[model samples]
Target: MGLITEARTEKLMQNFSAIDFRMSIEDFSVRVLNTLTGVIPEFNKGRVMIKSEDKIYRCAAWKGFSDDIRNFQISEDEDPISADDTPKIYRNIYNIYRKALHGSMEDIMIKSGLPEVKVSVVVGIFFEGKIVGKVFLESAMDIDISKYDLYLLKFVSKVSSLFIGMKFFQERERRYHKDIIMAMVKALEARDTYTVGHSERVALYSVHIAKELGLDIKDVDKIYWGSIVHDIGKLSIPEHILMKPSKLSPVEYELVKNHPVAGEAMIKDFPWLDRIRPIVRNHHERWDGKGYPDGLKGEQIPFEVRIVTIADAFDAMTSDRVYRKSYSLEHALSEIIRLSGKQFDPEIAKVAVDVLNRVFPVIRNS
Candidate 1:
């Protein structure tokens, strides 16, 4: 009997068509693997392995095996998929498994409750003529696959390659955008020597705080980007005012306070940055309605902006300035705890201090 019938082949194609490729690469891989395995019964076990930059194939998605097998990898030299573009069948390759896994195949099968593998098919996924990944299927011993089954596997590989390639392209494009933004940050920092590395530190602190607050990856990512450019408006301020070693006059202080509003204006035209506009503009706003530009207070402030607010304040307190020395981590954290309800959101500030203490454990309770 063949792996799939004519009617099942149509059903398989329909399942593949429903895949949403716009998800993150990790998610896309799992979606493709699940759909492929769910629509076919001839295969009892399978996995998708993606090639890393080191030229090793690592398991990205799997089925019917302990997740511990995710650590299993095949070097380029040992991976048969690396040398072949078409589906190839291997029979009883126990030595191959032993070499890669450092154990007998029977040991793994017994431990993982996987049946002994008698026949397996490997299909390579390629993009623009370069091999990128593979799909390995463990076939049931009672069933024999025909040429049509191989053709269907090849079709699935082609679709998987296209989807995976698009995800890689999107990642590259995002990195390019971030590079341009970082250049702008460097330019701003060049003028204000006192705030050198301020944006990056705030971004780091914001990420830690956002994660501690239990925000999802997408929200944490937005907070990081917003924190990176939170002070971008300072670029428009006078150079002398920014670098002044003495106390700023009231007029100079007012100009300095305009930065958040100016930063929002700087990136407002960028539709891609629309999500972070509120964060850039309102990060300075206090919890008690005493902050600059607009006095959005309490819950009126966006949750993301609230997180950045604490991070921005914490970095400023702990960093060296032209006017005063940097505060110790312990002292800075003490101030954060003290002003929680007045300057920062009470809940987020508590989480931030706890997260920062863990990050700087040497100063904990000291």
Candidate 2:
């Protein structure tokens, strides 16, 4: 009774690879449960429960159950079942109804008007030596699980655990890297009182434009991170020059213009940030070949860098500088539209003006 054939196993693996685990947890949970039910059609009812920080197992996904089941919880200290790295079978689930903690499964099922469960299987989803989730398969009639059924369940559980582990570690690594970058931005901002929030605003505006242009998630993320650290090279400039209350000398202005190349060089050695080097180096490049560094004209500039360039210019216009007051929102948007074909990519500039018009007003009022 090998229920899980080689072809079925391969199909399941292919399905797993197709899922984008970066989706919301609720969506991920439902997909996982549905994928399992699709493979084993006999298990008419099931739920996926995730372990929360409060040590309670809350149902994250469920099918063929009343809405009341959505609120069901299982305490970590309960005697209903033990979750190890294996699936446990129960000949009669009713026997565990009273064994479970009060107000958990018993009360919820009663209120939901669920029928009697004749048999059930509980599979534990484990990660890093702890049970992170539980998968329950139940039936109203006494059903026998073939050896292949158990093997397939185990395979699914292991695959779920692997994805869960990878997602958790990736999020943690992203957070760690973001923290370091923010700290650098803060230090750089502290050196110039007038530009305390320039980098963050530029990043936010760039993301808005990127999304409006319907860029994919990966490019949107690159635009954001690159914008956040776009001015990293300016950290090497003397504080006196950055905070100068008057117009900069030719030499000082030249030093200021080199920040993009300097910033690119500063982060060149970090493999994780390597992809964004062009963005940091070319955000100031012009559309008509009059800009600095490499003077990349037209499409020669990276698309992401062009996006950040518009965002940077818009924010700088709206923020007060050491030598002048900030421009009005109307003036800034008009200026962006005015220079669309000259200083900026005409297409990105058009999209950016629309996005900034809707987004910046709320930000200014807030």
Candidate 3:
């Protein structure tokens, strides 16, 4: 009996660990209930119900149980179980344990339809002091579970409950992060109304150029993000300068040109964004060391930044701006080719021209 208890304990611990390591809550619940049924030999059929905020126990995960039992509905309006309904073996246990061990309480119960099945086990899971879930197990053979097995079930329940809690917390964190990023982008958009779709357009053009260049998918995605946020530093510039109706003075132009550096600083602390920061910061740098902020020349600049810069410049020139009329597709393509090896990387400039030609075929003839 002692050896059997130890084996059951080990099996429960292993199942708990596996469930805890799962990436999704649905998968974790399914795996835990399946493993529990396997370890508890007397458990022929199992069903798991999770307590929702609506004060109802909803079906979460189940195995070896009919759809009707698995789909059984229970709500807060259902009265709590009376004292007489509690099983004799679970008399001294708490209400949670009574529901789990006896399978006859209102919170969690299992009624076997087959006459051959005589015993059933229900396990209630408590999280943060409240009974949050229950597992029902049925058996055809009469087998008395030891106290040790009961204790092991309680431990497994606690671990699985914590796993569910952590999953909820992680999902909330992801949404919070997404909300913050969107807010920042919206704020930037409000300040630079003329460039409302600038980032998105650059992203699209950069992705196309990257594909035409036969770049890897990872590199292509990096270019896409870099292009989108390349002008994020414009947020730091005053609205007057950003929306100036005339060409900027030399000093004003210098301030305006520092946006890449400012944008890099804005997103530098994000670990996932670290690789793209340099690309954002140096997108304006010229190949011949004549650009602002950093005059990184030739091969010194990152390849992804170079790709984004060409795409961004093409979109900027072709789109209508406060200080300049939109250039025709032919004019923009000619200007990009004209600046090759000086304003842009010669090789990337060639690829950019090819991409534009393919996208706007009439530009090639012009």
lDDT of 3 by residue, 86-199 (tens): 112222222443344344443323331323344545566665556666655555556687666566566666676687667666757756865675677668878866677677
Model 3: how far is 157 from its true place, Å?
22
Residue ranges of candidate 2 with Cα displaced over 4 Å: 1-38, 43-124, 131-147, 364-366
Best candidate according to lDDT: 2
TM-score per model over all chains: 0.88, 0.74, 0.52
Worst 10 residues of 1 by lDDT: 357-366
Whole-model lDDT, candidate 1?
0.79
Alpha carbon deviation, residue 353, candidate 1 (Å): 1.1
Ranking by TM-score: 1, 2, 3
Worst 10 residues of 2 by lDDT: 95-104
lDDT of 3 at 272: 67
Regions more than 4 Å wrong, model 1: 1-4, 75-80, 83-85, 92-94, 100-116, 139-143, 360-366
